[model samples]
Target: MQQADIIEGIKGKYFQKFGETSNPDKVRTFRSPGRINLIGEHTDYNNGFVLPASVDKAVYFVIEPREDDQVILHAADLDETYTFNVNDLSKPDQAWSHYQLGIIEQIYKKGLKIGGFQTTFGGDVPVGAGLSSSAALECCLLFALNELFDLGLDRFNIVKMSQKAENEYVGVQCGIMDQFASAFGKEESVIRLDCRSLEYEYFPFPMQDYLLVLCDTSVKHSLASSEYNTRRLECEKGISILKKYYPDIESLRDVTPEIVAEHKDELGDPVNRRCKFITEEIQRVQDACDLLVEGNLVEFGQKMYATHQGLQHEYEVSCPELDFLVDQTINDPAVLGARMMGGGFGGCTINLVKKEAVDDFEQKMKAAYLQAYQIDLPCYKVKITTGTEEIL
Candidate 1:
C-alpha cells in the first residue's frame, strides 16, 4: 500500500478505537521514515561518516493526550494494545511497545514531565529488511511527544534521545545514523553525518535518472546481532593496541590506512582485517561525498562496489546470499552499485539501478536468486523523503 493509504488505514483504526475528540485541535499525527544508507556501511559505530536518507516507508501515528497519567497504545497493524501509567512505567506486555516506553523512561530520567496519551501506530516499513523500522518508530513517537508535551527539546535532541532509547532500553549498541536520518532527513537529499561530532550536511541526491532498489535476501542469519557486537569489540581491541603506539587515537575514525598498515603485526589477525575495512570505508565515505558533489555517479558507484568487497572479504559481514546479489550487479550496465546494508550477516542489498532497466534487472535477479537459494527475493522500490514530523 502507498504511504497515504497506510496513514488513512491507521487513522480509521485510531478513530474506531478512541471516539472522535470533542476538540480536534487536541489530536496530533506524525510520520517517521525508515532510512537507507547508500554507502558507508558499518562505519557509524567506528565514529566515521555515513551517507543516508529517509525512505517513503514510515511508521505513522495518531495521538491524543489523556487527562490522567495513563498511556494507551494500540498497534493498528498488529491489533495489539499496551497500557501503562506515567508514574509507574515498567516492562511492556508487548515487545514492540518498549520503543515507546524507552522514550518515556529517558524523559523521566532527565526530570522532564510528559503527559500521558493514547496512540494508534503502524507502518509499511518491512521489518528485518535493513530499512531501519525500529528507528523510524522511535523517532516518530519521540517527535510527537516533544510537540505534544510542549517539551523544549530540539530535533537533534530528539535524534539523540531516540538513539539512547534503543541503546539503553532496547539493548542495541547502534550508532546515531539511523535515528539521525529518521529525525533530520530532507526530501531529495542524503545526509553526510559525522558520527563523532554529531554534525551533518545535506547533499542533493542526484537520483533523477536512477532508482534505489532494495532486494531482500529474506534470511537474517542468527549471527547478525552477535557478530555486530563482535565487530565492535574487535575494533575496540585494535584501537586499544593502537593506543600504545599513539595514545591520542580514540576510534578507527582517528586512524588511517597507512597507520593501520604500519602496525599490521601489532594489530594482529582479524583485528587488522576489521580495522582495515573500517579505515578504508571511512575514507571511501569522504571520497564518495566528493564524487557526489562533482556528480560523478559512476565513480561513486565504484566506491559502493569497493565497500561490498571489504564487507565480503575483510569485514566478514556479508553472507553467501548477500554476496551473490551484489556480485550480480558488478558488471551490469543498468546497475551502478550494490552493497549489503544494515547489521549485516543477512538482510537487503541496496542497489543503484537505472530507472529504465529496473524491471528487467528485478526479473533477472529474482530468477537467478531463487534458482540459487530456493528462496523468493522481494524487491523494494524507494525514494528519499523528509524525516519525522507531525502531520496534524
Candidate 2:
C-alpha cells in the first residue's frame, strides 16, 4: 500500500521490473493522479458540469523504450507483466491491460505509429472507492507515451485520448471529468469542467479549516457497471422525450428544474426522476463554483447534501452502505457535507469536515460503520495537487 509519493520508491520498482542490471539512464518515470468530484455526480456523461480536483493518490509509470514493436508491461502491485506486439493490440484476458492497450489503440486510430516500450506501473488510489483509479492508470500511460515518444500531443489531446481509451476500450462510459482533472489539475484548486464544451476554469480551494476525506464503503457492488450503463440509457431516454417537445434541450445540461417539473407526465416515472436529479445536480455544480469564489464552505457543503438526496431518491444510484455513511453524518457538527461519489451503487462517501474535529469524526464513524456492517471503514485524507508530471 505504499503510495507513489517519491521518485525513489517507484524507481526501485522500475529496477524490480527491468532487473538490477538494466540501464537506468534510458528509463523515465511519471505520475498521474486520481481525482475527486467535489459536487457534481453522474453529470459528466450527460454533458453537464462537474467540479473535480486531483489528489495526492496517483499511478506511477516507470518506462523505457524497446528496440522492437513489443510492448512489455509490468503491473508492479500485481507482480505481473504481459507482453504483446505493437503491430497487433487487442483487449487481453487481464483487465488492467485493457487501459494500456486502449490508449495505444487510440494512438493507432490517429494513424500515429509508436515503437515498443516497457513500463512498470502501480497506484496508491484505492480501487472501487469512487476515486478514479482507472483514469489515473490511463493518464499515467498516455502522458508517459506522449512524452517518451515525442508524439507532440498537447494537454487537451492527452486528456481526450485518455478518456477515449476508457470509453471504447475499457467499456466504461465515463465522462471527461476524471481524465481532465488528472491531466489539468493545479495545486490548491478545483477545476470546473463543462462536459459539453470541454472548457474549464480553476477555483481556488482554500480549505482553511476543513479537509476532504473519503469514507470507503469497502464494498463494490457487482451491479455498478451494469447500473451505470443503465442510468446513462435512462438519461438519454429522457432527453429523447424532451427533444420532441423542446428542441432547444439537447442534453441534460440544458435541462432545468422548471422544465422537468412541467414535463413530469410525459417524461414518466424513472426517466422523469432521472432527468430531475441530473438537472438539479448540474445546477448544484454551478452553485458550488460560486461558493468557492465566495469562500463559503458551509453553503457549499449544504449543496453536497442536496446532491446525495437527489442521487439516492431520484437517480437511484445509492446502495445501503453509501446511504448509511451519509445518513449518519447529517447531525454531526464536524461534517459540513457528505455524499456518495462516482457511478455508485457502492463506493466512498466524500466528506467535508472541520480539521480539528477530523480525529473525533473518524473515531465515531469507524465505530459506527464497523458495528453496522461488520467491516472496517477506511478514510482517505486527500489534498488537491497538480496533474501528471515526470518524477524528475
Worst 10 residues of 1 by lDDT: 19-28
Candidate closest to the true structure, highest lDDT: 1
Tell me how candidate 1 scores on lDDT. Answer: 0.90
Q: Model 2 TM-score?
A: 0.95
Per-prediction TM-score to the true structure, in the order listed:
0.97, 0.95
lDDT of 2 by residue, 234-344 (tens): 999999998998898889898898999999999899999999999999999999999989999999999999999999999998999999999999999899999999888
Worst 10 residues of 2 by lDDT: 1-10
lDDT of each: 0.90, 0.88
Model 1 error, position 302 (Å): 0.7
